[model samples]
Target chain A: MAVATQDSAVRTGRATRFVLYTVLLVFALFYLLPLFIMLVNSVKPLGEITGGSMIALPQTWTFEPWAKAWSEAQVGVEATGLRPYFWNSIRMVVPAVLISTILGALNGYVLTKWTFRGATVLFGLMLFSCFIPFQIVLIPMARVLGEIGLAGTTTGLVLVHVVYGIGFSTLYFRNYYAAFPTELVRAAQIDGAGFFQIFWRIMLPSSGPIIVVCVIWQFTNIWNDFLFGASFASGSAAPMTVALNNLVQSSTGVKEYNVHFAGAIMAALPTLLVYIVAGRYFVRGLMAGSVKG
Target chain B: MGFLDINNATKSYGSVQVLHEVDIEVEEGEFLVLVGPSGCGKSTLLNMIAGLEEISSGEIAIKGQVMNGVHPSKRNIAMVFQSYALYPNMTVGKNITFGLEMHGVEKSTRDAALGDVAKLLQIEQLLDRKPGQLSGGQRQRVAMGRALVRDPDVFLFDEPLSNLDAKLRVDMRTEIKKLHQKLGTTIVYVTHDQIEALTLSTRIAVMNGGYVQQLGTPKEIYDTPSNLFVASFMGSPSMNLIPVTVRVEGNAVYADTTTGDGSPAALAFAAPSEVLKSYDGKTITLGIRPEAITDPEGADRNSTHIQSVETMVEVTEPAGSDTFVTCTLGGQECIARMRADADVQPGQKMPFTINMEKAVPFDPETENRIA
Candidate 1:
């Protein structure tokens, strides 16, 4: 009787495992289906892509469109081309991420650990700014940037990204700071660490999860910023996203689909790299501030 | 000279007052424990002394120097947090020497201090390990070492042992008392544990509702609490407070009450009736600690204001050293502590003696001591 029961239990366990695997496989396919189609279409010739099944493998793969998208597009003349646009995006996005993250960390530190008059009200105002539509302030912000001669420059784009980025960054940091046990800050205070000292020596090192959140959020927002890049830059100062659009537009003139595909891939590579490297931090930030009052 | 003096200190958050006008004075090399329940402002008062929290009004001076606006580091005081907030990024040795390094102490001097404190805390072997790799007890020791290495004017602890397990808490309590004896630094400790307050403090300030209810030696706080809160809060299993009406018969004072097993017992006091004459026919609360109520055989007859009562032992807990017999008296549950070997069982009728000689009377309406 015991042997029969053990066999039944093993069968049940196998059935459960089979069902879990089937569900996971179905979910993975649901997300991968689009990417698979895109990859095959991007490699296929126009005839093969138009005359075959959308799910069919490409009959012939070619790198001609990628090459055409690069040289003939002359994307660098407008901004930095694909190469300089990549560098420009890095230039604009990196500093935007760093400055916003630092400001967010300091704001979160003070808001969470220190008590001052009207701090909550000021935080409330910052929070309210997050919900305001970006379109509402576009004209006024453009005028302000133009008046300062930053309207068409990479520096102006970075400044704009940081100003807009502070709202969400502050939110991320404040929530992250809330989960951090306040006793640690208090202990540092008692150890004689002043404001910046504690922030630099103590809080910053322990801020792995929040820094990931800030980097991922700011990089994705600033790097993929088509609206700001296009609106602010009319000359050789556009970010890679704007330059990628111009590449696609000019690619049709030369019939260069492969270079457009490569440039599209290039435009996305930095954010993809950021996500891959800091994916753990993104998940940790979600879990770190789970317990709050 | 007194090492720490808090003169008329007051604190509040917005309009919600946490601590009222308060005053305390500690002599040099005194171990004072401030104990109260959560939200009683014990931690807040400790923070005020540590300069972690601002005092809304009043002066705090350490070593005869005014410390009102002086930063915590400049105040030259060290504090051990309840959470054992060892910097997670640093090794144990680094954590211990962080304060010294901040103050620009010579590296050789800092190393020597670290060596001495590590050996003192018996954490010499664990010096290189990060705080995350250590157990809770080890992390606590590192926190203490961090504060101890500072060798400041005073050491403030905010419920430092509350995070440890029961056995470790007892061991750490003794270790702290020993450390105090050896260092002889003025220490102000805060805890909600009465036993910790009793064993570790030279003087204890039992606080309630932001007020220091009583500041006295442990025995005084235990035996003669200033009011009902202190009387009820000081002892474990707490003092039993039964409402009773005072009656006088033939120049004798008697408190009439029904025993546990449906029997009447009148407990009498031998003191002069005049001491309680004004309370005749008035309702009052009587406070009696569990240990004060003993078995009849072990009772101190001369000193005992004995009340023989017939009470059914509803529950008997034998905790090795003592047997706790909980019985119902006058419809109120009362616990009595007696010898463990005493033949007592649940659902058995036992004759217990009430030691009323040290019983205190409290005003029922005001919750204050009547005498």
Candidate 2:
């Protein structure tokens, strides 16, 4: 009788899950509609973009907007020989992601297992900064960067992004580390492992999921940041986000929505490429050790 | 001089002391088990000996050498943790050979050591598997193998079997005992399970509230616990402690209590004058093992002057070779072991005899045994 009840309960659960999937599929389409519309508009001619509906495909597809955006928008390269701000974004974002992820793991390690006076206070400060609005710090950060002679360079932007990125990265790392059994650390200590030895050899190797989270989070944040890029980068050093803003609203003529849509697609490609390449690791990372379930 | 000596070892976090001046000397190649309840500081003392925690005020010496400043690895000690703590990224072979690799053992010798240890643990077939692929018991064996590969001077086990299922725990218990017998290495194990302590230890230390209540051979601790805590903590179907008064009747001291039959049951002891002078008329706790209180005619019989009480059996449990009968006496419930086929039923009045010779007296207020 209990088994029969359990079987029916399972059937009901499956029905519930099927309904949930239907709802989620509808929500996914809702969330993805803008991106789909932009992709379709990017391939359309100028007349098609203005004359047809937003979701309609172009009768005659053209690559003219892509080519124009690549050159005129200075996405591929610029006149100053610095290469367009687009490639510069990659150079800055990659290093920022790597440094932030490594340092995030280190921060998590120190905060969780290692004990020191005022450690909790330091952690509280990190969490406190996450609640502060970025607009409030803009003026002060600009003055500080100007004093340090980093006001209009890639270094200033990377530095600022790392500082803002540490707040969330540390949170991801600390929570994950907390779930790990302390007995493992105690056993490692008993086996004669020092602080860094245990972190590098034991803890870090099992931390694939958290590392992916940190990388994806920091990468997207630094890559798509318009405020920091526009404020801190000047001339050819500015990133694609700042350049896209210029192309969309520059006072040269009426806005060219086709080129703007094409530029937006190019701007979003790096992050999309990363998600596609590392998607497996992303899921595996989040659900590490959950196979026991 | 002992192989390991913990002298006046006490530990405290800040204000509350966890271990109060515990002293014990472990002999060479002796398997010693420290057993107690959760907050008993058995693990704390074990951690202190492993150099994982600082000794609050006392000295811990291994083989007559002070170990306070020595690192855990430098102390020539190996530990098997409950969680196994195997390097998750390393294969079973590398996990077992990690200590050797750390000490820079040559690749060929490391491989040989790994092979020998893996074979000893019967994990030769699991050499290439990561920790995630192994079951709980297998991971534990790998942990033990990692500890054993180094062949350290002393082995420290901190509840290594607590994570296994009941059957696996029993199996691993036997395996650990057999391993200890084969290696004949000095081992200091800690657990809250009394049966494990009784079965595995050359000596058992019963701890409570940061104090070593008693330390003796298993038989000695079981037969003659130094206090009420040791007596109750070290036994299953724990020893029945009845609060009774010792009264002097002429030259003999008799423990007097109301029997289940509503008649006074009295146990007379030819009082050793020196031990009985203070308790001439005061109430004392009479400690008796369930086996000691048995059927009238049994393997060991109490002398006629000892005592006999007739009580209605409240419950009877037949456990294959023996029967456990619980009866009430003097408002306290007492359990007794009798022959499996005893002609007794629930609610039947039967005279259960008490062997006063094996009974010990405890000071009612202090709970310590009256020596």
Candidate 3:
């Protein structure tokens, strides 16, 4: 009787696991279906993309669309491709991410360790900035950029990204540093470390996971931003997102569906690469608050 | 002036005063332990001394130099935090040497100091490991090492061993005592554990309600607590306080009390002090340590001050070295520590000897010690 019960229990366990895997597989496909279609269409020729089934593989695989998207795609009046806009993005993103992350680290250190009266209120105000829609700030930002003599340049876009991105970067760093023991800072002070020294030697080194989080967040936000890029930047200084939009939306050409998909994939590649390389740290950063030092 | 002097130090946060005027003077190489319950402002006082918290009033001096408004790093005092705040990213070696490096000590000199501290802490083998990789005790050692490497004029410890387990806490307490002895540095330590204060301090300041109730040597604090609170708080199982009326008959003074079963008993004083004479015909609280009231075999038989009284035991707690017997006296639960070998049982009346010589009397009105 015990053997029979054990056999039935094993059978039930197997059935439950089978159902669980089946459900997981269905959800996996649901999320991956779009990416799979984009990848399939990205490799296919323009004729096949418009003529053949979207799910089927290309009859003759070609890198022409990717090459065209990189070099010869007409974004505006000229066929300057995504290469220049891509470089423009790189110039804006690298500095913006670094500057914003650094400022966030300093803000977090001050808010958590060197706090004074009304520090919480100040932090609350900064956190409120993160929730404000960028569309509302566009006119003021444009005037400010113009007044600051940074308009129509990559510098203007970089400044916008850094300013808008500081809120979130500060929030991430502040919460991370809040979980850190204040004793370490106090100990460092007693050990004769001044403000910047403690930050450079002690706090900054321990900020690995959070730095990755801030960098990835600011990089992705600034990289994929179109509204600010389109409104602020002119012809030559436009970011990749703006150029990609112009390329896809241009009415002068033959639509070029495959080229549009390839351009979309190109714009997404850097952020995807960031995630793939430092994805482990992303999870670690999220779990940092829950698992204290 | 002593090595470290805090005169009339008071701390306030806006309008709320957390610590009242507190005066403490520590001689060179003295280990002063500030002990109190939570919210007693012990930690607040320690932070003020560390210069981490601003002092609202009063002046702090180290080696006769005023330290008010001085930066903590400029104060030349090292502190071991309760959390053992070793930098999580740095190795134990780097954590120990960071202070020296920050002060711009030559790399060779920093290495020498690091080596000495690592050897002293017995963490030489573990220097390469990060704080996250260490055990609680190891982290504690590293924290002490960090403070010790600086060789500062004064050492401040803020409940440094509170995080360890019972056995480890005891072991670390002894190690801290030995460290103080070997280094002979003026140290100010804070803790809420009275036992730790008793075992480690050269002098202890018992705090309550932001006031230093008593500050004296451990023996003085334990044997003659200044008030009812100190007497009750400074001992394990606590000193039992029984309300009694002081009676004077001719040349002798005696306290009128009741046994466990509510039977009236008269406990005659032996060589009563002058303070007790004024309290004649007045009600007072008699404070007695648990060991002072014990089984017949455990009592000092030759002492004239020892008197026997029959009391009914309500319960018995057998701790390995001794048995704590609880009974009612003067309508209050009183515990007596007896030898483990003593044949005692619950719900039975036993003749327990009371050491009246060691007992103290507190005025019922003021709760201050009468004698």
Candidate 4:
């Protein structure tokens, strides 16, 4: 009787599954409708996008707006477009993500494995950093950036994102490294491996899934960050999000919705690509310590 | 001086002392096991020897050299952890050779050591597989192989066989004993299993609540425990401690106690000690192992001092190899080991033999054995 109930539970009824799939598909379409509209409108001419229904297929598809958004749109008093800011975001996000992830991993290692007095309190404080609103840190961060002589520079933006991203990445790696067997660390220690040697050879080698999680999280967050970009580094060093915002807001003549749509897609492309490549690992990393070894 | 000496060692976190002043000198090639219940500081002692934990107040010396502040690696010790602790990312071969690599041994030398250990452990075929892919026993072997390849001054094992299933645990226990025999390296092993401690160690340090309760050979600890704790902890169907009053009548020593029916009974002692005379008319705890008290037919032929007691068998457990007969002595139920076919039944009168030569008396106040 238990087996029969289990079998029925495992194999849902046809009507139930049909309803489940229907609900799932509806939710999927609901979430994806904006992206569908953006993609549909980005390829159309300015006239068709401004005058026609957004969900409608373009009567005449063109890549001119994409080219304009990529290189020639007026962004922040200049028609230099988002190309420079795309590279700027790259320069900022890459270092920011790498530094934050590595530091987070090190912090996690020390916090979990090389624990001392008040380590839990330290971890609690770091976790508290994750909850602080980005707006609250704006003035203090800008002042720190200014004091460091990095204000209005891509390096300044990188520093800003690194500071912001460490909390989350550390959180990810800490929980992951917490589940990591301290026995292995002790074994390595007895084997004559020093602190950095164990971290590099033993801990880091097995930190694949969580590293992916941290990197993806940091990348998407730093890449899509407009608030920090607008606050500290607002000039030629603006990131993709900031530049895209400018390209839409700094329009003087006609409201180029197609160009704006193109710029938004360009701004979103990296994180989307990141997810496409590492989405499964993200889920797996999130669920790492939920189950047993 | 012995090979490894833990002198006046104690561990405390702030105010609470976990391990009291412990002193144990392990001779070269001695297999010393620290056995105790959980939270008994056996593992803490092992870790201190491994240099994984600090010896809070005292010193540890290895080969006449002080190893208190020395790093675990510098101390020349290898440890097998309970979880096996094999580097999950490394293959078994790499896992075995990681220590050598860390110590800057040449690749050829490391490989040679790894090969010898793998061959010795009969895990040569499984060297390329990761620890995750290995069975619990195989992982245990690889863990040992890692320790063995290092050829340290001593090997430390922290409950190494605790993770395996019962059958595998027994097999691995024998394997570890065999390994110890093959390589006469000094070892300090920690386990809560009394049987493992008995079978594996040349000398067993039975610890309780951080103090070394008794330190002796398996025979000494089993046959003649120093205290009630050691007496009760070291044996299976742990030594039945019966409350009896010592009644000295001239030279003959007798334990004046009640039978199963609450009637007065006197069980005589084979050899009376001066301490037994001192405990005259005073209550004492009598310690007797289950096997020592058996049916008359199954009693040890070598033991000449077998005292017979006719008692009501309150319970009889027929455990395939031997029947465990529970009988009340001095108002407390004591279990006796009998032959599988022994004709004993619950609530029936049966003649149970107590080997007085094997019985020990403990001071009721001190809980220490009365020599």
Candidate 5:
């Protein structure tokens, strides 16, 4: 009787696991369905994309759309493709992410360790800046960029992204650094280290997980930002997101669905590749940043 | 000038003062432990000494130099933090040598210093491991090693062993005492554990409410605390304080109290001291250690001053070597330490001897020791 009961329990457990797996699989497919459709439609020629079912695999897969999307797709009056704008985005993002993350780390260190009498209030005000919508800053940012003689340039876009992205980067680093032990800093000071020496040798070395978190966060935000890119930049300085919009919305020629999808995929590939490469660190970073120790 | 002198050191955050004007002087090789309960500003005082926190007012001098605004590193002191504060990223070797490296010591000198510290701490094998990979005791040793490598003018420990388990704490306490003996370095240690203060300190400063309540040798602090707070705070099982009415009969002084069963009792002792002589017929707080009041058989029978009193035992707690027996004196709970093998039982009226020679009285109004 005991053996029979154990066998029945095993069967019930297997049934429950099966139901759980099936539900998870459905959710996974439901989330991935759009990407699947985009991939399937991206490889097909224009005629096949228009005529065939969207869910089906392409009847004859070709790289023409990808090639055209990279080099010859018309965006505005020119057909110079996404290559230049992709480079423009890269130039803007690298410096923006680097500068903002460095500034955030410094700000976080000061706010936590060398805090003066109103430091907490200052931090609270800085944190409040993270919630302000991008639309609210566009006009003021444009004027600032113009006054600085960086208007409609990649440098202007980089400056704008760094200015707006610093709030989030600072928030990430401050939370992580606040959890970091202050005793290490004191020990370093007692060891005859000056301010920058302690930061370089003690604080920055222990800041790996938070750095990964801030860099990835800033990269994704700046790379995918269309609002700031469109408002502050145009022509040769337009970013990938702005160029992709122009490509997809151009009305002079017949609609090219495959090229549009390919352009969208191209614009998203860097961020997706970033996630694929460092996705493990992303979760670990978030967890470490949240925990005090 | 003393080796390290803190003259009227004060600390405040905004308008609220946390540490009042405090003064302490240490000789060249004294292990001074600052002991107090939590929120007593012991840590704040230590930080002030380390130059981590600004002195709100007054002066701190080391080796006859005023250190009010000197940077911590320039103060020529090293601190071992309560958390052991080992650099998480650096290996033990790196952590120990970081100070030397920051001061621009050459590679060879730094290596020699590191080797000496590692050997001294018996942590040579663990030097290559990061702090995260070390056990609690190992981290503590590395913290000490880091401070030791510097050979600073003074060493500061801020409750360094409080994180260890009970057995490890005792072991580390012995190791620290040994380290101090071998190095003969002037040290200022802070802890809330009275046992640590008693065992390791050459002198102790008992702090309460931001004031240094008393400062003296451990034995002096233990045997002749200056005030009621020192008397109660410095001992385990704590000194039992009972309100007793003082009476004088010729040359003898007696404390009148009640037994556990509410029967009247009086304990006769040597004549009251001049300070307490005026308190005749007035109630005062009588302080006696637990061991001083014990079962008759467990007490020093050869002493001429031992006085016996009958009381009902309310509870018996056998703690290995000694059993702590609780009873009532003047309607207040008091504990007596007896030998573990003593024949005592709860709810029984037993004759317990009180070592009247060791008893001290405090003024009820001022809570200050009278005799």
Candidate 6:
């Protein structure tokens, strides 16, 4: 009956379609409202943003705020011409994502293919990591970092993110590899291809979409992470998120909302760009190795 | 000793044994089939032989060398799995030569071997295509090429054609037989299809309930199935088993039973075995193949004695090549494979000529052949 109703609605309901499109358009506009406001204000002269409506477009459309945000912003964890902190974020994210994804793929491979006695219990323990509040680990993680003498370094931050990222990355890959054909693995074994050879040559090549999903998930999480960055890696090694916070909250004589807007957009731009480039792949990869023909 | 010998091999998962002591000596260049219904441990036995499954006890030897703890690849064997199990990411050439690459054979030699196997399997045109790009038959050919290129002592095929459509399955079956003929390689194949077992194997191990029920050539297995299970399992439409009592009358021995209508009918045995004579007053299963019980004109002419029993035809099914006439005999429904043009209909009296020379008697209690 539901199908029949949908069939008839699909054939005849122009008014229904119009209402749906109108609602969707309204939501799309509603979500874009803040970004629209920020984009408009970021190019306006500082005097103009401070004077009146934040909604109105800039009269002069100067790129001074963007330039200041990119290279001359006074966040100052580094004097590397603007602390662009963009590079800082990338430094933290790239390794964290790569290491976590590779480790996750290996964990997934072992859990699914070379399962041992306590594998389920071990996987369950790792799954527990995904759910544990980040707050629960902060003090212990800080203590461990300090004990290991990696307290405020970029390597320390990467380690923290890698540890935090494994649970989710493993979950994605474990589920994907669980559906991958064991027969192929067996065939590879009979072909005299050892453990790592099969994984590299066969499993890894076919693991395209899941790898994309895993990388995207880890990239977004590690890049935008303010909590870990603030708690663990402060000082010059602070990631873009922590630096962006410093820039916005520093109160350096004048309240430069334009610089703040410009900085926030720059901080959020990499993840947004990633989404734009690989968002479709993220969805496709999530479903890869999941269904068998 | 044969080229490959499974000496009392058994397999178990924890406490539950899946395959019992299975012994079969596969001669070099021989084709051995393990055929049975699902959960009958045929595939498990095949896996045990392939070293994919550990033998609970006993041993498998190839070239008279014990392979008890040998790894599958180390055992010098290759298997074509039911799914064809082609590495989807690799091109056909890469898939076929993967084994050689793993064995550390240099590219020059590996490419030459790949070319030879590709030509042999007629998959030369498919060398550049991924497994996903090819049709099911093409994947099957590539899978076979992968196995063949290895030049292993044994080629194990685990229901390799079970994934194909019926027509393609038949074509591949023929191609496989032809390949075996050409290569003369020892192969141990597992399948649940009886026809495939009949057509492909030089020897067959009919297994059931964790035991090798009977091991024989196709003719021996089909014509003289050692037990009731073998009789019922090996043939399409299966062998008709009728409960009959033996009666000794001077120089002749007869199997006497009632029809579906409770009317008595007696079928005499031609050249009754001495063991069959011992069941004079006891009941036994009369095992007769469908082809052996047919219309008078369709009966085997070479047989010396053909007993005709008039019975009520319960149904007549024309299956293009043959008309299967189902009739009531010995208080059970028996099917006879007659010529397509045979005059037969439902609920009519028909004479189903039973070739008594081809019939075997099984002791009712043990289910083993008495004659």
Q: Give the lowest summed-lDDT range of ten residues in model 5 chain B.
A: B269-278
Clashing pairs in 4: none
Model 4 spans > 4 angstroms off: A1-7, A10-24, A76-78
TM-score of 3: 0.95
Best by TM-score: 6
Give the least accurate 10-residue stretch of model 2 chain A, judged by summed lDDT.
A74-83
Tens digits of lDDT, candidate 2, A34-60: 999888888888888778798887888
Once fitted onto the true fold, the runs of candidate 3 whose alpha carbons sit more than 4 angstroms away are A1-27, A50-54, A291-293
What C-alpha RMSD does candidate 4 show over the true interface residues after superposing them? 0.5
Q: How close is each model in CA RMSD to the real structure?
A: 4.0, 3.5, 2.6, 2.2, 2.7, 2.4
TM-score sort, best first: 6, 4, 3, 5, 2, 1
Runs in model 2 deviating more than 4 A are A1-33, A47-55, A72-83, A253-255, A277-293, B249-251, B270-273, B301-307
Top candidate, metric DockQ: 4
Collision count for each candidate, in order: 7, 2, 0, 0, 0, 1
Candidate 1 regions with alpha-carbon error over 4 angstroms: A1-68, A76-81, A251-253, A291-293, B242-283, B301-315, B326-333, B344-351, B354-356
Deviation of model 1 at A83, angstroms: 2.3
**lDDT of model 1 at position A9:** 64
* Residue B238 CA displacement from its true place in model 4, Å: 1.1
What TM value does the first chain of each candidate achieve? 0.83, 0.83, 0.93, 0.93, 0.93, 0.94
In model 5 chain A, the worst 10-residue window by lDDT is A6-15
DockQ of each: 0.62, 0.57, 0.82, 0.90, 0.85, 0.85
Q: Regarding DockQ, does 1 or 2 come out ahead?
A: 1
Error of 3 at B247 (Å): 0.7
Each candidate's fnat, listed in order, reads 0.71, 0.57, 0.95, 0.95, 0.98, 0.90
lDDT at B44 for candidate 1? 95
lDDT of model number 5: 0.90
Q: In order of the candidates, what TM-score does chain B achieve?
A: 0.94, 0.94, 0.98, 0.98, 0.98, 0.98
